[model samples]
Target chain A: MSDSKAEASTVPSQKPVPKIKDISLMKAWKDSKAYREYTLFVQSLNRAVHGLKNSDTVPLSPTLDKLIILLNQLDSFIDQCPPKGRSRFGDAGYRDWHGKLEQESQQLLKDALPEQYHNYIEELNGYLCDSFGNSTRLDYGTGHELAFALFMLCLCKIEALTEQDSRAMVLKLFSRYIDLCRKLQRTYYLEPAGSKGQWCLDDYQFLPFLWGSSQLTDDGPIEPKQAIDERFYRDLSNDYLYLGAVKYINEVKTGPFFEHSSTLYDISNVAHWSKLNQGMVKMYHGEVLDKFPIAQHILFGNLISFDPVPKPTGEGLFKKPAPVANQ
Target chain B: MNENSSSNTNGDIDRWLEWIKDCKYLPETDFKQLCTIISDIFFEESNVQPIFSPVTICGDLHGQYYDVQELFRTGGYPPDTQYIFMGDFVDRGYYSLETLTQLLVFKAKWPDRITLLRGNHESRQVTQVYGFYDECMKKYGNANLWRFCCRLFDLMPIGALIDNEVLCIHGGLSPDIGTIDQMRIIERDQEIPHRGGFCDLMWSDPDDIDWWAISPRGAGWLFGEKPTSQFMHNNQLSLICRAHQLVQEGIKFMFDEHLVTVWSAPNYCYRCGNIAAILAFHTATNHETKLFNAVPDNQRVIPSKTTTPYFL
Candidate 1:
């Protein structure tokens, strides 16, 4: 990391590790190379997961298996740091578990990746550490989920995970990450930081809806309306990320599905999976990426630079909304 | 109670109340009319509207429409049991439109029976960030209803005084406002500003500190027992009742019972697994607490199987 100054002096054009200093620079972030790369990477993975089930056979690289193991090890820490008897919504004992994660995460990342990638651990660990919920607030949200996505993008940028591993990225590593997050949410009773209650998407994650909708695109079995049906989600959950998320919500929350989950209920009214997938991509940009509250916490580094890419002359800064079919 | 309280208006309000009791929202046109009718009633009230004893004081509703119904069932409905709702009527929960509409209709019908004080969430900025703005857009396909609601929120009273002894507000105290008279001088018919007495009254919280401290919420000050006691003593108030933060026990009294936070949204956001309560004052000093849980799934109406709205 100390070499950043020398490298910047030598290259003259390289941006120093990106840090989101304020909300005003968010427009520059939208025009940044990092933002483009991140979204492109996510769309690539989204395409890779199209028409695929979790159970379907796919090659898992050793790097992914080690990362999954790291998540598993972190999961086991929850048992050791069980929530103490407390009256508050967020348990205090989570601070202890988070403390443990902070202490061991760097070493854990070193073990998970090969020696060739050890140099990037300092930058990578920040994303990995923040991927879990906040220790102070004892809550998790789509912002933390964004950290994990950027972590994956960093892996791809560093070539630790090749283009061939894109399918396994969402199907395996990301799936395992979701499981760990759900466990943390339940065991620790993490609050939904800055949640819009039932009006927003699900309390914790939004990627599953994005990538999950992609899995259902075109030849996928279920339609948008049928996704909420218990008969479909119950059996297909293990096989589909979208159903798994839907099933998870149904388990925790009480009340009618449409009422408590009005946003998804409205989304359920969409006719086709492809249209839903397109809308979800748009939603992720509007809700998660463009939002100042969520984006403020995002870290820009050597891997994810904040320097904007120069636009072609006469191009509009704001692009028109992508047209949807059957609107 | 006022000149607008005609028999026809009462009948319309009664019908709206009945319709909302089923958890249905008034149409946009009807909702606009309700907001207009109630804004006029609210405009005539002072910043700290005077309320009588034997009224029920409740906390944040947060769009939990069913739990609000449960709250009424537990504490008795308005007119029978006068209510002073200390703000936070929308956001977080599923039915913001239905929930706020019911309270507004009740206020329109029996303006004298209920005191609807504004909460922090009532502001245009806060509601847009929260669920109320989105809920409005989703329900009506536009933000017109949300806009009308925000205008109504601006005109709503800030605090209520129970026989001039207990001060009921949405959030907590402001250092700039030491007396209740200062509150009255505030021109509160606009968006809540970034700072000042008006903003602090709705955004501030009570913390374990000595005097005024910067609040983590970024807008308000976190005043300790010293400020609380001083404000109460200055205003000759016996108690300060507010509802901005969540209380797992439904009601929490702090600083030796000088201030209390009554949270009426149970199992907040459908997951906190907390109880809700309301304080029923027989007199200004003596009150009974009624605790209630979230409305069970079976008790609430599940939507009937209907035709699919979308087709490929």
Candidate 2:
């Protein structure tokens, strides 16, 4: 996993790698270097953020603070582009905010990342720019969330962030990024991009629940169902991403939890957080990584190449047979 | 009416309707049968379905089953107050199976009283991307019902003409189709195409531009007032009624009253906070928009642990 450390001094390729050009390459995506690193990185962050709270102090990193400031700057732009008099969902004003992000993203990335990593700004900027939301669609979802994660992954590969920063990345930096995303969502009324509505975990995100569930591990005082209880959610939401998301849903939506968010409500029925966390990881792989609609938009490059990894002998024993060519 | 009612003699459609009325889905076998029955009914209908006056027009139910019940309540139950649901009956909401099943049962029971046009979301690809496919797997523990429903979707008519004047479709006009007769000639029994008249009819939206522009949705073109009015004039239509786009107001009249959008899923996605509306046409020249909000929580049946989809 630390092989990236060896390549830290090497400059990345000049041009960004081509995106998942077609959906047929989805099989290749599973075997890509990026997929391997992403799974490992997510697992590491999952372990790092375990039992953490928004209030709990973690090892401080200047790089994390810079990223937070960059997010803050973008959040302030929402004030600049207050939603136009509402027509319906996906306000036009979000386009303006996204436009601002697009224009200043390179500069913002330059400021946040250490000067040593400045050479990687070209590739880094695309992920950071797309991380906010789509300007044209005025929508956000796990695809954009994936972009932010990729940005952090780029940072990790470049050694701008290291193993030590994983905990701070999940607790401090990623938390701020989601906060900014929420502000943009509420302020601009960003639509959910390719949302499965009630079937999906949440409208705008998937990872926080994955990482958040890890925070709830070790048979804590709260059970899975209790996470949605107002008494527990209100008290623990700040401490746990999963509960905070439920609290947000409660605020924005008006209906029984089971009716509006049946998927999450059903998930709450699981007996333990560890089980839920493991399920979340598998789901992220199945639902997000494997789904063409999401995977098609992912940009593949040096840090996260689309090139396939060598399939280990007898690997087919554990995995389900690969799906036949898509119709 | 049609002879399809004879199939309901077995009382399965009625039983399914009763189950759906109570917010439950039909059993897997019954659901497959209903799909077979409804697909046959829709297959016999034309690409441009012919609708009568004194009908209520709706848009995009998106599977809000309780809101649909409220809609039936607001605008009298079908057959009493005939309906032309301009597509989008599934996806996004929790009760897609029930909402779609109830509508299908209504069509199967009273083919003459209700018209179900195809929306973009009706297609197999769209359902896979949206919630309906997952909902089927979650509820039935398999994708067979989803496959049956997708077949039914392919069989649905793409457009409806009310009194030969008001052309109602899930989306707006298509550049490939200048006349409703052109729409009539389409072979629509397959997944929606990426382009051409058939796809455009189910994916297009109206804008204030002069002519056709590329739609952001990727499949259809963004038709403006000029082409819309020209299409109406060419077809001698008085109004073009569509339902693909959400209007903050339940009903929106655009292009100087030449086009109208009727949305029927209130508080869409359980959080949009926008009311839904249905248009009741008293005559070719007259219609009323009936508005309704989302059903209260207590009014809707909450799903037990055994029913809802487990994230795993």
Candidate 3:
């Protein structure tokens, strides 16, 4: 009986061997100690961007040119890291990365903000707290913090552009940001776990901000009402959309979103990535003051609209339809 | 002449005595023995076969004790008919220990009738998370009874074939299980803690949709309609009945009307305001199965009598 079973089990065998490219890719990632290397790369890029912004040797446009180079380098480092198929980092690694990022980002902001803009920085920090801290608030999760940080980065870029040629730079920056946002929005909502068969923003943990026909508007000078509404809406929308997308993706790919094995860091990462995408959209439109009439009315209504009224919560911001392609 | 007559009489007497000595003892004077002999002669008169007239086929009580009693009141008690409790007697409710004890006492009294099977929640890990662990600690002040109950849980049969027609189990079809005997071979001993073992048996959800796959949550895999239809076809079974997910109407039919989920616990944990039901079927005739709501008269308040037996 055993012999018969063994005979039955026997089959012709031809198996493929690992290719040279596969081996080299594995070796490169393994040798690079990608996690630590990526961290260092991010830090260096941050320093390079800051140095270029502060350099006396170059004019504003040339300085931005150097900054763009640094940004490209940062993007390359992220690409090379190759998030897919990497072993999940343990708590220690996560904590180490989180601590380093927090420290570096905080230092960068402190150094970048002028002494006169101390009050503005304080207000920004306070806004961050209000947006991210309140449990009732939509942005009251780790993902919101990441989204806010990404938004800050966009602001920094806008500031840099404004220094060179106020009107042209603003228009250019706004257009680019809007285009990027639209692209990301389409990528996230339409394709959903794109052709690559991977979750778009694995680290985003916030709930999706947009629910049932709501979109952010681009207003000029961030008026008190527009600013408050934008802050609240974006924070909440980002939270809901990011979380919802991740959950949807997880459900399709896995079984359920939140389960025994899911970690806090995993959720946070997905949330952060989602915010980055949304911030990209917001920043893209930040400079394009002419394109969005209604948005302009909501934000800079006193300047643009002859009939100005008290801005109700999300009244004007929600009037414009979401972009068709993104929708 | 006188001597000859006496010898004849004595010889007759001696033959009679020998016959009496050889005979089995029939003690007329021993009252106890005499009583037993008389009782044995009339024993057939008292031999009465208990008639199990009606029984309720309960599915997935799931630690909802209040709901179980509500069911009992609605369905009536056993001995008149028996209860074929289809397992999942613990977990996910505050009163699992009471639920188990009440069912256990009922089973002990009527072992031939009140039957229970092993469910996924009957496992250690499930109990720990759901309510059994806390219930045991609160009731017994120790984990000893919990451990014993878990042992008994292992012995529980995975599936019950009702009158050789209706098949009942806690969960749905598995790729591994083929025959009734295959189910019987499952060792009712300590189960190894793993994904594919007894845990999956109690926890696996069946898919009625086409092209099912493994769930990423690591609990169990999902199935599509094709596999479900094929399973039903191969098994020579009429319907696949299972309970795991919450059913709004205490039952749900899925998979092109092939799969049915019957949840016996209603207003599940006093939340999820759902009506609970039990499936009743007559074996003799291929009559359509009946669904009975075990919900109480007042929907708002859970009756006090329904407090789990372990409390008393």
Reference interface contacts recovered per candidate: 0.44, 0.71, 0.00
Ordered from best to worst TM-score, the candidate numbers read: 2, 1, 3
Can you tell me the CAPRI class of model 1? acceptable
A1-327 per-residue lDDT for model 2 (tens digits): 345544534745444554677877878888887787777778878877777776678776788789889989988888887778666678898888888888888898888888878888887887888788888777899999998999898887777877677778888899888888888888888889999977888888999899999888655658888888899778888778888888888888877788778878888888788888888988888788888899888877667777666567423211222222211
Worst 10 residues of 3 chain A by lDDT: A191-200
Q: What does candidate 2's lDDT look like per residue over B1-312, in tens digits? A: 346756554487677777887888888888888888887788789988887798999999999888899999999997798999999999998889999988988987898999999899998899998889998898888999999888888888988888988899998878888888888889889999988888888888888899989877778888899998888888899998999888878899989999998899998888888889999999878988899998898887666775332344
Off by over 4 Å in 1: A1-26, A217-223, A313-327, B1-11, B208-216, B303-312
Interface RMSD of 2: 2.1
lDDT of 1 at B73: 93
User: Which scores better on lDDT, 1 or 3?
Assistant: 1
Docking quality category of candidate 3 according to DockQ thresholds: incorrect
**DockQ, candidate 3, vs. native dimer:** 0.02
User: Which of candidates 1 and 2 is the stronger one according to lDDT?
Assistant: 1
Over 4 Å off, model 2: A1-18, A218-221, A311-327, B1-10, B307-312
**Window of ten residues with lowest summed lDDT in model 1 chain A:** A317-326
Which regions of candidate 3 are displaced past 4 Å? A1-327, B1-55, B197-199, B284-312
lDDT of 3 by residue, A1-327 (tens): 112113212422111111223222433322222212222222222222221111123333533343334323322332232222211111122223223333344343345544433323332333222222122111122223233333333233223222233211212222232223222222222111101011112222221221100222222122212221334334332222323343333333321221111221122232232333333333223211111211111110111111223234423311122122222
**Model 3: what TM-score?**
0.41
